[model samples]
Target: MKKNFILLFLSASIIFFGCREKIVTVEAEKNTNKGGLLFKIDKVNAPKNVVMVEAILSRTDFDTVKASLNLVTETSADLALNNIPIGAWQLNVNAYDSLQAIVYAGETVVNVQDGIITQVNLTLIPTSSGLGSIYIYVNWGKIPTTAWNDFELNPILPSPISSTPPLRCNQPKVLYDDGKFKMWFATFKYGFAPNTGYAESYDGFAWNVVKENLFDLQKNDSSSYSRWDANCVIPGAVIKENGIYKMYYVGFINSSGEWHIGLAESKDGISWERYPEPVLKANSTEYQISAGDIIKINGVYFLYYSFRYNTISTMPVQFTGGISLATSTDGKTWKRSETNPILTKSQGWEVSRIYYPSVIVENDRYDMMYMDGSGTGFGMASSKDGYTWTKTTTRPIFTLADTKGAKAYEVVYPFCRKINNKYFLYYSSASNSDMLTITIRVAVK
Candidate 1:
């Protein structure tokens, strides 16, 4: 035949132009795999209605691959997958509604390739009638009362007024009298002898360490000059005005290596009256006062301590701390808060230093709860004029995994109270040990 029909028409025109050049090489390798994955959906402040998310992919033999995404929604949900395909896969979201039920389901596991995206951020915990029930207001005024209706706040007793064993303790100070509640702490026995303890709760976590040596450095009776300084007094009671109970301690003057703030006086809470001098005195050789914390609000009296300074060294000392404020009308002549160090050190976990300031007068505000000494735990600040403050980007309300032997190099000092609507936080935890251990946490509405 004519040269075998021109060699079969040049082999059928080279198999029809090689199948038209592979039809665009199988549609451009169907996503050539340069890596890609990005899905996000967080809804904790929840409350939205249009739902219908699907996204599915699978491999490892579960066989079903249909990818091509891009679903956005601003404040949350954002998924984007392009040119995926490099290896392990298995996503599978679902979020129906419109009565088709389902509500939400998730699964994850991605790998993709090298251009980088692999995000994966999902948080969906709704389904308790679509969840919504945590609106606590507890007399939220911000504080300025004359005779009650300032919404009366001090409710904390839902179940933990007792756990037993020096299971941690801090600067708690409650004495509602005659119906009894008398609690006062500062124990660290598990970390080894930190005195000034007393407990008796008609309800406050079932305590009972009544006088575990209320200021007793092994009975240093210089003929009852009442010597106590195996290193601490730590108390901070309060009741003033005719029912007299004032306590306020921080002692450690071992012949002037200085750390004073002592002053005691009780009437029916079981004998005490040590005040031979030390109404607060580190007398600034460049600052040094330790952890004090008093409050008499409105009739004045503040205190709040923890000021340190000495970093400009010629090689004699070198410190640099902060957290000061002072003012007294008669708690014994003080004065030092013309806005003085109201709070400092900003940035995640309190930046570097902010110490034991624990005020509370809720419903008219004045929260404070310091000790972020450089964060990993304990922080909260608020004031409507306890001298200006706000701090709280959901800051460390309390952490170090909430205590156990504490660690992110521990140190905390919260101490709050509000009993009938609930909120108690007696905190303190130490690590590089100078012996600090105390704990009590409760929060309700």
Candidate 2:
């Protein structure tokens, strides 16, 4: 057999074609007392743009038995085989393109024993041998410690702890200024109807929460006129420019939760004043704005927010959407990006939604850590122009499983700040797997 390797493109549609190999089950036997072997696919070597591949395992004795694996990914996964009755086997893999044509092929031989696992490696060549040279790109960007760490620590004040554990708290926007770290977030006393709260810290660890809400559901509680932010308030981003503190926040009109981005200004970061109305509303009735983050590049303000499809099923749930862009000069009246939704959903952990973008602008690099879910994962993406983005990895940067602090049902709302060359990440996680008892937690790198 001609031996070579294949470029494994794991994202293609799998086709169940009839091969003459007479395939059998690849599943391992329960508590197998005899022969079995485990194979770890360590590398994906493939020609460019080949999106799918299949593997065939066969071993001939008095009779022939075969098993086929239809799909393989770039990520490493163990291919477990059990009860093989102790013998040598043939492993053949073929890479296919969208047209269901084989582009690359490789085969190898392995031995199986009573309790040992076998490993196989191969190099593939193009089916069209003279199709020039092939190039393969495997994206495996790992989150470095300098990027951020997944270490979890004790919660800050009014967190999962303090005087009374919060039943619900999230949308934490933390800012570092004048040798102190200040946080503005939302605390839920009436379910989704949250009230924005404030806290201060000198070192970003021990925190002091203000006794009262920062800017409540209204510009003032005494105002009887119905305001756009009357129902709920969630803090999004905070930036101080020209000695004035500007807070971009998410607001809700009623139980319908037509979320909009609103603004509030303060001098001392304690007492806040509102704009009386929302600064930005949804683009259409089919969409609902969730949260907004702000970044200033070359004296231009960039406000990026997340919006979701306004369906009946999604309205009742928490935030899940894609990140869109808008720009402003004075940081007030803004123009939407011509190419909106600069970042979007991906496969695996990010398939359901990508929202709550917290971006940091460092020179030419725009690093964004956003909420990636079905629930409990955060993803990172980088951009050069701030309009087009590429995900850092196929997986979440760090999950709640990396925290080892909260037994969380869902961990969302990532707001990141880089201070003194160290990254500070503040987000909410459920306390002990109880969704209602959500609170803020911090990690530093």
Q: Kindly report which residue pairs in candidate 2 clash with one another.
A: 4-123, 4-124, 5-123, 5-124, 6-45, 6-46, 7-45, 7-46, 9-51, 407-433
**Residue range 113-190, candidate 2, lDDT tens digits:** 554433333333343343211212111112236444432333443432334434356778888888667888877764
lDDT of each: 0.51, 0.62
Report the error of model 2 at residue 295, Å: 1.0
What TM-score do all the candidates reach, one by one?
A: 0.24, 0.62
lDDT, model 1: 0.51
Cα RMSD of all models vs. native, in order, equals 25.5, 20.8
lDDT (tens digit, per residue) of candidate 1 on 1-445 = 0010100000000000001110111122544554544443333222244244555767753346443222223443444444445666666555555564555454555555454433333333233244211111222212222212210111121113233443455556665566445766665554344556665543333334556557655445464334434456667545656887888777763533566677788876556777877777776542556644676777887777776665666476555576777788888777777776877767655765777677777667777777666435667778886778777645675666544212324545656666544455555444334543334333222
